[model samples]
Target: MKRVLFLFLLIGFISKAQVKPTIQKDDIVRIETTLASDKMEGRQIFTTGVDSASAFIEKEFSKVGLTYYKGLKNYRQEFVVRNASANNVIGILPGKSKPNEYVVFSSHYDHLGKEENGKDKVYNGANDDASGTTAVIALANYFKELNNNERTIIFVCFTGEEEGGFGSKFFSESINPDDVIAMFNIEMIGTESKWHKNSAYITGFEKSNFGTILQNNLKGSKFRFYEDPYLEENLFYRSDNATLAAYGVPAHTISTSKMDSEPNYHQLSDEVSTLDFDNMTEIIKAIAISSESIVNGKDTPTRVQKIR
Candidate 1:
């Protein structure tokens, strides 16, 4: 009788595992390579490259069965920055029960366009943000497949982040901050963290209990999320999450880049070849798993303190 019960449990576990949508390294590679390729021309804001990249993202969202946000005809959330046209590709997966409450996943898609000095003029920006954008796409596909989110999920690829975060600033003004439950702004996960393998850090870990909620969700997993090591840099307010965070939303940026020693940082050498696709795949998977509770409305992160 004991053996029968053990077998039944094992079968159930295997079935659940089979049904899970695993984020694959190949998917990461495909998305990152295309976005970081020379043809993209670095995806700089106000450049043809950025427009092409936004179009590509829109196609991917449609392919994944994501629809436009409410009252929008298409996925491109167009805006202007310094009189230059900019776009934020947005897709929505409405929740089953609580469609008004939102859990946002964002990544900046813009990068340095071209350098004048070097023969390799293109700044690929694979590690700076292409990796994060790839993760956003993969996460969208995963959630679409699972079809189990209880709170609305918003996937956004922002432009003009490198040019002073105009995209996010505009977006923040357009939304009601109270409806936003949490924001996961993924950035620079192409390489492993300085802490060790399968680890990443969240900026402004002390600003709220958001990191705690994430860590608690990841209990028993090998992946570890830690506090930002370079607190002195005030990294929490430096990224695209800052705008929403100012309005008291629990927004944070997740990354694994070693700011002090990262070789490729903003240079033209930051290409897809420089990234570790395996580590990136693991990071994306960890985010998807840890965010399950928030997406399902089982957990809500503490609000960040409103900045003056």
Candidate 2:
């Protein structure tokens, strides 16, 4: 009977192992372009454009058959930004076994709005964050299809990353920090890194062993995750991952943007035309594959040192 159980588990593992990148470039392009389109008006917070972006993301979650986050009636995790209202679009896939443990996949969707000038009023922000949001959505779809995670997966597209990390701050406070096993915060991966294609850098890499575990998983793949090269820029605490990292979660930002020279960084030319969809698709797949063991509860990374 024990032998039969071992064989059963081995077969299941092989089946999961053999699964390739199911998320295609076409699907990624469609999602990225739509989010970065001029029609979305740069997805600024507390505006109609950002509202539309959230709706589109919620629709995708619905299509993936994801459940609402805990204590929410829908996918929108709403909160007040002073007098105005803003929200984070969140969805969850409950674990098959370790339901209490959580693995978070996050990216901020907010970006600069239209400027006063008629010359390219839309910032587009295709690479700044629309690409990252697209990745989160794609990962959600891929993991949902697998349906074997032992850790509950939370996919969130944060708001107000440009103004501040208000969305992530609220989210971190809403849940117990101890319950969160890891946080994969993807940002600005539309372009290839300085190391070139199929490569990314993780911020706060040395603070925890998260990057090492991820690298260990991609033993045979061409893709690579490197330590953040622009340490002087202090990227580890810049994005939505900051708040969670402060609480001692193994939260890290995965990015390819070159801080010293990204030509389109916050410029009017940050559009889909500048991105490499094929490479972006590969980055998303690498994230999905590298994170599988953690989701399956086979690996646990060291926690970040609590700053707060």
TM-scores of all candidate predictions against the true structure = 0.94, 0.94
lDDT of 2 by residue, 1-308 (tens): 99999999999999868464398999999999999999899899999999999999999999999999999999999999878999999999999999999999999999998998887899899998999999999999999988889999999999999998999999999999999999999999999899999999999999999999999999999999999999999999999999999999999999999999999999999999999999999999999999999999999999999998
Candidate models: Cα lDDT each: 0.92, 0.95
Q: What are the per-model C-alpha RMSD values against the true structure?
A: 3.4, 4.8
**C-alpha lDDT (0 to 100) for residue 137 of candidate 2:** 95
> Across residues 1-308, which tens digit of lDDT does each residue of candidate 1 receive?
99999999999999877487789888889999999998889999999998889989999999999989766799988887787778899999999999999999999999999876677999999998999899999999999999899999999999999989988997888789999999999999999899867999999999888899889988999999999999878889988999999999999999999988899999889988888888889999999999999999999999999983
Give candidate 1 misplaced runs (Cα > 4 Å): 1-18
Q: Which stretches of model 2 miss by more than 4 angstroms?
A: 1-21
